[model samples]
Target: MAEMIVLKGLIKRFGDLLAVDDISLDVKRGEVLGFLGPNGAGKSTTMKMIAGFLTPTAGTATVCGHEVTEQPVEVKKRIGYLPEGAPTYGDMTPATFLDFIAEIRGFTGTERTKRVDAVVETVDIKEVLCQRIETLSKGFKRRVGLAQSMLHDPEVLILDEPTDGLDPNQKHHVRNLIRDMAANKAIIISTHILEEVEAVCSRAVVIGHGRLLADGTAEDLMARLPYHNAVAVRVTQDNLSIVQEGLSALGPVEAVAEAGGLTRLRVAADDGKARLADVAGLIQDKGLAVREVFVERGRMDDAFRDITKGETMESLHQGDGNA
Candidate 1:
């Protein structure tokens, strides 16, 4: 896949505060990059520069090989941007708003109508098409914002909190649309939502204090958790003590509460590697009758917090796959 979005040494400053500091990243076609950071972490600042809405204090932003500063109009033509809050003309109805956007994108006559209709259906905003944007529910307003972003079918999409106000169904629909579009476009979505990244993003980037802190696939990030590939064993209460004692030789054992006449024990890998087979073999040798065993994928929520809150990535490596 071609690299469609690139930022090098990107910096943003307001008065004495540096909003984005020496950040850099690239998004390739067929990839959805989750741009994540805590509140006031400069995620949106970096995005605004990439989308040509804010000029960088230093460094360069590029889209489709066009430098954002040198070729703002060309860059805009190739990107679809959904800003924070999904701002729109509150007085305009969805129908008029989409049509107006289509016209602005150079569509005409039947082509314009098709674009408008396609996005309305894509976002499932048909029912609210005739209502004013401000008058619609928050979810409906968000859908309208989404419809406008994709109205021109731009090759790159920069969505800030794409599912911000969406309900479950709307979020699912938008995420599915993002996945479907990933094969053809390079997408950068700024969101603090962890599951959203896991669901649609092929790569995840973490920023904190206005600096690029981590970047990798979601699995890579998760692998840094203490129990990334840890083993889980479920057995009858009778075997619980034996299993716990035996597993302790391999790594720390955390026992979960008993349920349904069974006790669950989780064993973290000492070497930060998947050791399920090693554990299973131990059970086999001991003639232990275990109910079930599985490898854990680790906790994403913990990983996200560790990655974004910490000052340095090296100190937070619970495993080797640090971004």
Candidate 2:
């Protein structure tokens, strides 16, 4: 539960533009922090400052107790960074590229060979080990980049779009690898993919205009959506009104929409909290033959859209957690 990475009022400005407006956050060991934002939202910029790739315009960033600006080399030695696009030396084969990384990380002789072999196997890039990085497919290239970042087995990991070029299976593979490694490391993953937040991250941070908009667990963010835990009842066309009116009587109905010849009803909670069981009784009492009934837990994309549109966290139903 130790804090591995901490940002205190971090700020990054590019000439006239304040790319990363004063923002602060923390990533603790044994936690996977999903860093999310829209394009040009300063996600990559902030991460760069933390990784020592760019100097911050203001504020401070620390990795494992070492200040990024003051002890950049020490910070670099304790963390693994995979930048956006997973850039690598295209001319070198995976074997050579990883070996070079191992050496740079201070591995030597047998230790260097062991680390390279372990990473190559871990990323499952043996098939392309001897292939030039440019000759390898995008997915393979990304795997190579991942291998290099993990070669040193650092305590903190800063991955910017780690699964950018991967397909569904490949993405799943990488996600599983991250989960396996999460117990002992503090990981910061900057990505546009929402599912990755749900899949691997223990907590998510949403930023916009370089300011911290929302910070909490995935469920906390989802609870901001109006449809959080809303139930959907699909009844026959003839019974649409009956179902709608019956459900509305039970609680406030948000909307009733038709799709695929079935009516989907969204019931709302008056106190900004969803009550699922109340709707179930209405369906039974009405004796309406329902084709389908589903409970929506919540959707991250919906919350993201709302947050980025200048909707403050305070505006969301505050009973649900918000930061």
Candidate 3:
């Protein structure tokens, strides 16, 4: 199942508005790809196209060598999709719901019971298995959705906000589940949660304005941060000017927020890799008494905003000009 998921110049439009635009990517088995973007950035729409729920306006998507439009059933059979909101049959219990799903997927007898039990335990939904879905809490409902998605053990998983309603313990459990299954499946998780991408996904694909903005390992995306791997130095208020001036010779120095009798500054690395010893040496060379000096890891939250926000602003400007 290597390269099980592929998208080539995929585009989706709802009338005059373009939802996904010219996005091309491939997901290999053993790779957990984080589908990241702000709301309405077309993450769901693109996933839908690949899942064969929505046909693309142009281009194509394929799952396991089956072009979605040409072989829709083949594609669906290989995919385990948990759409947003985790919609379920309000009248049915989780037990019945999963049984129905197992039957639909052609599992029967002891094998069907075995699969249902496995996913129910995996998702920690034993207590709520017989409760009507509409009567369950949001978290329970979501877990039921997850259980159904995995009951068939599909080769590819397209999870949209899989942990949206779970508590911390449940979230942790599900993250572990995803990691455990990642070795044999091509998984694409669409979530606004940045930490999930770091913890679960092996690589990340960021989309903005319906375009593929960045695609790389989680660390690679974090490197896009302006202060990624920059050195942070804290000096007394009196030494702030002297310290920043000395550090600027090494690279750009970012002025950090001032605090009580102290000022922290970040020395930007010219090549995005700054060492702590470099900053330490500078402080020592000046014989300055600095309270703290350390290297700052790239902040993922800031990087996400910068990537998506910058493109959104740019697109707005372009629209304004056209108008």
Candidate 4:
């Protein structure tokens, strides 16, 4: 697939703070790339720069071979942007707002009318097309914003928090719409919702503290973090220490926590393989009646917490040492 958007060492500063620090990315045609980060993690700043809404202090960005700063007008024409808040004219109805946007994009006559009607139908805003924007619900307002963005059928779509404030049905509809549209255009979806990545994106890019942390498929990112296949065992007695000792004899137990009359043991082997059977055998040999046993899969939230916390601790240690 062709590269629709490219950034090299992209940097942006606000006074003494570096909002985006030396980030680089390439978005390909017909791909939906999920942009993820914690709050204030520079995800929005990076999106703004890519959409030609903010100028970078250093480095460069290009959209369809045109420099963002040098040819913003041309770049804007090739991209459809839905900002974070989905701002719109409160006085104009959906149809009128879409018409105004179509005119700004240089559409006229039947072409403008056709495009507007098509998007209104695509986004399912036809029910409230004539209603005043201020009177519409949040979900309907979001649909209006989406209609305007898709009005020109731009090759690149930049959607920031597209499903914010949407009901479950509307969210599902928008997710499906994005998936259907991804076949013909490159999309960069900036959202904190991890489930959205799994639902609609082909790949994901995770950023932290104004820097890129991980970029790959969701499974790839999950594999990079440490995860132990754990076994939750419930014993007849509440002596977790005894169970912990017995489990340790079988293998190197990474962690043992007791909760709800059960000892959850995370065992680690030299090869880091699943040792559930070994764990069960150890419990049986110890004469402990296993009331229940189950394998627990590692969660993405655990990986995210470990990575971000480790980075934060390292930064704090460095600062303390310097002081």
lDDT sort, best first:
1, 2, 3, 4
Candidate 3 worst ten-residue window by lDDT: 314-323
Using TM-score as the measure, the top candidate is 2
- Candidate 4 lDDT over 1-323, as tens digits, reads 39998999999999999889899888888899988878888988998998999999999989999999999999999999998889999999998999999999999999999999899889998888898999999999988888878889999999998999999999999999999999889999988777788789998877777877666766655544345355556654456567777877765655444666555556653344557788878877887655676665456666566555555334323423211
TM-score of each: 0.89, 0.95, 0.90, 0.81
The local lDDT score (0 to 100) that residue 208 gets in candidate 4 is: 75
Where does candidate 3 stray beyond 4 Å? Answer: 235-252, 258-262, 284-287, 311-323
Report the candidate with higher lDDT, 2 versus 3.
Answer: 2
Model 1: per-residue Cα lDDT over 91-120, one tens digit each: 999999999999999999999999999999
Query: Which scores better on TM-score, 1 or 4?
Result: 1
Q: Estimate, for each residue in 87-164, the C-alpha lDDT of model 2 and write its tens digit.
A: 999999999999999999999999999999999899999888998999989999999999988999999999999999
Whole-model Cα lDDT of every candidate shown, in order: 0.88, 0.87, 0.87, 0.80
Task: State the lDDT at 312 in candidate 4.
Answer: 39
Q: For each candidate, C-alpha RMSD in Å?
A: 2.9, 1.9, 4.4, 5.0
What is the overall TM-score of model 4 with all chains considered together? 0.81
Q: Across residues 1-323, which tens digit of lDDT does each residue of candidate 3 receive?
A: 57899899999999999999999899999999999889999999998898899999999898999999999999999999998899889899999999999999999999999999999889988998888999999999999999988989999999999999889988998999999999999999998989999999999877887987777888977766767888888888778888888887777788776668777788876677786777788778877677888887788788688778774334433423211
